[model samples]
Target chain A: MNSEETITKASVEDIDRIIHEPARLNIMLYLYVVENADFVYLLHKTGLSKGNLSVHLQKLEANGYLEIMKEFLNRKPHTMVRLTQRGRDAFTAYRESLLNILQ
Target chain B: MKDPLLEQVQNDVATEQQYRDGIPRIAAGFFLIITMLLQMNGNGNTFVMFVPLMPTIIESLRKRFTYPRIGYAKVRDRGSMRKYSLWAVGILLLVGAAVFFINQVSPGTIPQENHQPLLLMWATAIIVVLLGIMVFTSRSNIMATLNAMGVVAIANRFFVLGLHRDALYVVMIAFGAFLLLSGLYSLLSFVKEYPVLTDE
Candidate 1:
């Protein structure tokens, strides 16, 4: 393989597949802009259904990309989500690699 | 190449649900009107005390009204906030210094009778400009509001250029009223759009 092909392969490989999903990408993008957000806010902003969002959030939490907290507010369950430091670094790397590949 | 996702992120941040409630604009409007009233009543110095409380008031109101509807999300402060704040303060000081310089250079240029009102007008202009910069973060129909503010600023400049003393009050009132109406309209629309979510 040529040097250019090798570079392209490296760039593609650097992409974080966990964050590359569309719904989770939307969640990450939304969360990235704010310090923290509740499940309802994420649901509203990401336009993801409850089940889908919960699943993606769980995957992200499992990957150590998200920190989620659960509490009862007014006798109703409320979940707050924020990005971990690892998540921010990973997202930044993923973005740089994706841009490099596109370029 | 421009990244569309980044653009969308910026758009989303600028038009966040918290900013959509028009609380900032409403607070700005109240501040302007209150300052104008205080100046008119010869209690101008008291208005300064209210400046520091503005943010607290807005935050409290948001907690009470807006957060319940859309949930809480603290936006990450942009670096530009400090830059804009510094620019606002610099412009305010520059205006004050220029006025002082003019008075020292030629006391006759501005009649002693008009000096106090002129200072008040300049102060009002500075407040309007600062509010304009602050509200630019929302950027939701703020272009129209900013354009209105721009027109007032430009017109105020024309009055100052012409050395018209009485025209300043009219300009200040007009700009303040515009912000008041704009904020009221936005707040009404926001309330209509987002009813408070009941506890599940």
Candidate 2:
């Protein structure tokens, strides 16, 4: 196989499919820093719409990468998300795997 | 196809900075006031000791103000925290040594009745260390010019402009007060601009 084909295969193979998706990847990466972030905070960071953000966040939660808490603040709904340990490990692995690409 | 992850990271970094924008000025101003208050009480090495906690105070204020508006993130990782811990230890050691030297060798390294220079040294050191943290950890430059102004204000205390130490402290204190007020104004503006849309 040509070097280009080989490179593409290696890159694609190493990428973490869960985190490789653009939106989930962004969500995981951003939450990795803070203990937890609110819905608005994440929304601002990702610039995603209410519906799209909810979908991506649900996906991450289903994957066990995200722990979401829904609370009522002043009779209004509030959502906070934390990156799980599993998620952090996945991200670390994802980052390590992407070293070649980043460089 | 653009790196949305990198973009989020960048955007969050900016948000963190915006959240912390005016804090350095407030901290510097706080230091100045504390310096004056300590001096008024005859200093006695007690007041100077709390200077190290400036970083902690800055963090506390940031959390207090930022939380009411936007939420927080653990800005530093474990590795980064360890690095800061080592630096904190090193700084404590350095300050301890300086304090010990001053107590034991006073009238040798530092002459009596010239306290402004001593306060000047503390002010500069604290601001530089605080500014370093800002530049490195949070990437906040909002206080860059104000930090410089603080140093200049304290250093102005040493000039031969015919100002007495008391007079100089007053001028320095004025600038410090103004800087802090500016910080408060910025903080209030931030609160207004970004009304808490979420209970989080």
Candidate 3:
């Protein structure tokens, strides 16, 4: 394929490094639909074990893609997540970039 | 303390998953609509009416539509298709036998005026079951399936009822309107998350 075609197609490397992992994508997508979701809901939605999801969520949180709020629900520790404005813009751009490459 | 790269990855995965989840629904919906239309025509034995058509539809869909883009690429295996066919055949036989036994056991229970509508309803039920099967086993798009269901429901209302052609047209138009609205809602939501890119 020509350079143009290559640009249009999201590289395997890009997909592997960025978009292909199972857990993080699920979390981002779920948050995109629901304004905010609790840690428990994320656990259910992603089907990721709590530890696994937590690790991924922390990675995302560190990356500035998400805001994690720690609060008390029923007097128990609860964590809620929401996409930051930057995260939302990045996600939209990333999606279009991927589609352009893939298409 | 946010990682843009990780966040981007998460969004991509979610979008792909949503599309993946929608596949079976789309397939089932298409089958449902086709079977409904066939049933509405009031021809052919119900026992095996859709049997020959299943493979044809799958093949045609695969050939005509690009894979992955329009959700056609997901049907990589024939195993689910075979299972679907077998299940359809078995259910059809069982229904046929039941209908036959019912008529034999109580000949007067089925009034002459109600026979056609009852048959239509039975056919619709069978199609719905088949749709459920597709949803579970196949990788079809959900939006496509919903659209197909809408089409079948509208067609069933018109043809099976033997309504005036004009009335049928009106019903079909209304059905189309509903489908358009629902489709737009789904598209808008999807688009909101993943906006269309334009080269300026």
Q: Score the docking of each candidate (DockQ).
A: 0.46, 0.37, 0.02
Indicate which candidate wins on TM-score: 1
lDDT for A62 in candidate 1 is: 100
Off by over 4 Å in 3: A6-20, B1-200
* Model 2 clashing residue pairs (backbone): A34-B73, A34-B74
lDDT of 1 by residue, B29-98 (tens): 6776777677666787787888778778877887677767767776666666547655655756786798
Candidate 1 or 3, higher TM-score? 1
Q: What number of clashing residue pairs does each candidate have, in the order they appear?
A: 0, 2, 18
What candidate 2 gets wrong by more than 4 Å, as runs, is A1-17, A70-78, A92-103, B1-19, B34-65, B78-111, B115-163, B188-195
Candidate 2 lDDT tens digits, B114-176: 545555545554554455455344333334433544555465446535455666556656766
lDDT of 2 by residue, A1-103 (tens): 9997788679869788989989888888788766677887777667777788899989889999989999886677878889999998898888876876666
DockQ of the two-chain complex in candidate 1: 0.46
Reference-based TM-score of each model: 0.77, 0.64, 0.33
The TM-score-based order of candidates, best leading, equals: 1, 2, 3
**What does DockQ come to for candidate 2?**
0.37
Give the 10-residue window scoring lowest on summed lDDT in candidate 3 chain A: A11-20
Error of 2 at A71 (Å): 4.8
